[model samples]
Target: MTLDPPSTVSTTSRRGTATAATRVLGVLTIVMIGWLGVFGLLLSPADRDQGDAVRIMYVHVPSVWLAYLAFIVTALASAVHLFGKSHSMQADRVAGASAEIGVVFMAVTLVTGMLWGRITWGVYWQWDARLTTTALLFISYIGYLAVRGLEGSRSQRARRSAIVGLLAVLEVPLVHWSVRLWRSLHQEATVLGTDLDVSLDGLMLFSLFVGVVAFTLLFLWLLLHRSRVLTMIDLSAETGLDAALAQRRAEGGVTA
Candidate 1:
């Protein structure tokens, strides 16, 4: 037997809450992004070692963090679908949204990294452990999206894609640990590590933090919009099915 649709009141309230949250987050994101742009681009002191080119860190680091955050959300949503059974469609929708955003951010990270590498290492690309593994991680998720798109049924597709999502998450740890595990040109974690180099300084760190916050808010806003679009598509499909069934019944009645 088919399950009944969710209560209109409950769905409406949830939609309203999501909309408000999206708006608030969008405004906060804009403000934080503006603040970061000014401080990182205009106010932060140039690095003694890398000179003016070091400013790229302000964009590169934040994009990597945002990409990681998106993948984490995708993994969580995939887990919810695999276990909970309920809201599987919603979870899949969220996973899809996060994956798309994650891919974009990952691309930014790679491009920015390449530019930084050219300036410092005198090469556009390197097969260093950290860079190689991170590139592999991004490619793996892109494959997941390709598989998800080709599937037919929502439930079947979700189950298959969720498994891929869960497996792809293993790469996250590998990417994070690659630098420590092997001798690489890439630097270690700056903000969270105990090394505490004073080169970043308080203002630079604060600006980077603001950029992170902005990117996070922007991710949420994008997720909410994508989720709403998915919900609407589902609703449309249901409406179409109902109309088709009604039409079939009407024709049968006329024949009788």
Candidate 2:
């Protein structure tokens, strides 16, 4: 009978679920995002105010929404890691996965916002409160990703990363409310908001909603894959470290 090494153990039930979810989400993302593309780009009527430029909303809104969501997930998971003594590593992995994906989505948000801004605000760049806060938010999380790579013990690394993850999310609220709190060119939320409501009806509204949902599913799919890969990498590293320690002991005349 062939015996599998501990590091090469069969997949857990949790991993199987993540794999299945990734497959399902992949299909849904392709279909829904594709549908949104056609609907937003061609079928939906151009805005009377912004004309074709409004089409950027379908991509921009969803990307920023997911960016917020990703940070929230990271913060929540980080909280668990800090509090949950036994299950800390699992929480850390989820936080790391979601934070990495969040950075990508935040970058997309900045790029798309700039494109839309060029048409609406007459400039591709601005130092408005919301824009400035958002840029800071993006940079802060980039730092969080960087900190994760520094050399440290597992406990020390996890503790530091978890703290950084929580601290990074504090910027999210500031970014969200910056326009409302101060004067800015950026429009307030259409589907979400109180003081600055914009009218979006018919297919335009539907397309925006579909884009949000599609991007959310895409985030989940990406997070699952990323976390799984991280887990495998950690396992391999641990296995290698164990082998090295065992070799050192055996060479010193200790039991192999």
Candidate 3:
């Protein structure tokens, strides 16, 4: 028995699942945001050290985590495009969407981080290790987007962007390790290893937990929507090209 072409199989599967996946992501986004708003705004306890200012973490930390998650998606999609010849086009399109969304989230993370830092660290900017690496990560993607936006043939642009995507991913690991590798004012990871402080009360922890869930669902929803839009744009361009070619052929036939 012959196997279906990899592109045919991949496209078929993605099309079949796209609507359902989008719906699920949308519903989950609503639930997550609702919970986050309720808990983060009204329930989480004030920081004893920073007072209410510490509440920014609910937004800042989650945004940073989601930014990393988005970039990781971009990198994985780019890798698939570069190395998996069979599904290169599909992978590149997916990577494009992921990178676009990743950039948005990265922007949010940087803004929120700066706001939090100003209130807590007593400054709006710092050359701290984590901040610097995060800034570099943001710049790398900005460069990627610039390259992507430049005029080029579709395949040529895709290949070039894929390379950039892969290279930019190097910043992700650096961003994560920056706090550990250098002396920085940024706080270390809290949820992963440390014991929870009981003094803050259950409502506060619960609110933050809800915020994380909400932001994650929101990210998924946004990613799916962005991917769909990119795919539609690609399809529209292909259709326009085909129409132009058909018109030329008709004119030539008439002249003959």
Q: Best candidate per TM-score, number?
A: 2
lDDT of 1: 0.81
lDDT of 2 by residue, 127-215 (tens): 98989999999999999999888799877788898999999999998999888899987877676777456578689988898899889
Better of 1 and 3 by lDDT: 1
Q: How many residue pairs clash in each candidate?
A: 0, 0, 0
TM-score for each model: 0.86, 0.90, 0.85
Candidate 3 lDDT (Cα, 0 to 1): 0.77
**Looking at model 3, which ten-residue stretch has the lowest summed lDDT?**
1-10
Query: Which residue pairs collide in model 3, if any?
Result: none
Global Cα RMSD, each model: 4.7, 4.5, 5.3
Candidate 1 per-residue lDDT, tens place, 85-117, comes to 485788888888888889999999999999999
Candidate 2: clashing residue pairs, number:
0
Residue 161 of model 2, lDDT score: 89
Which ranges in model 2 have alpha carbons more than 4 Å from their true place? 1-18, 195-198
Candidate 2, pairs of clashing residues: none
| Cα lDDT listed for each candidate | 0.81, 0.85, 0.77
Candidate 3, superposed: residue stretches over 4 Å from native: 1-21, 193-203, 254-256
Which of 1 and 2 is ahead in lDDT? 2
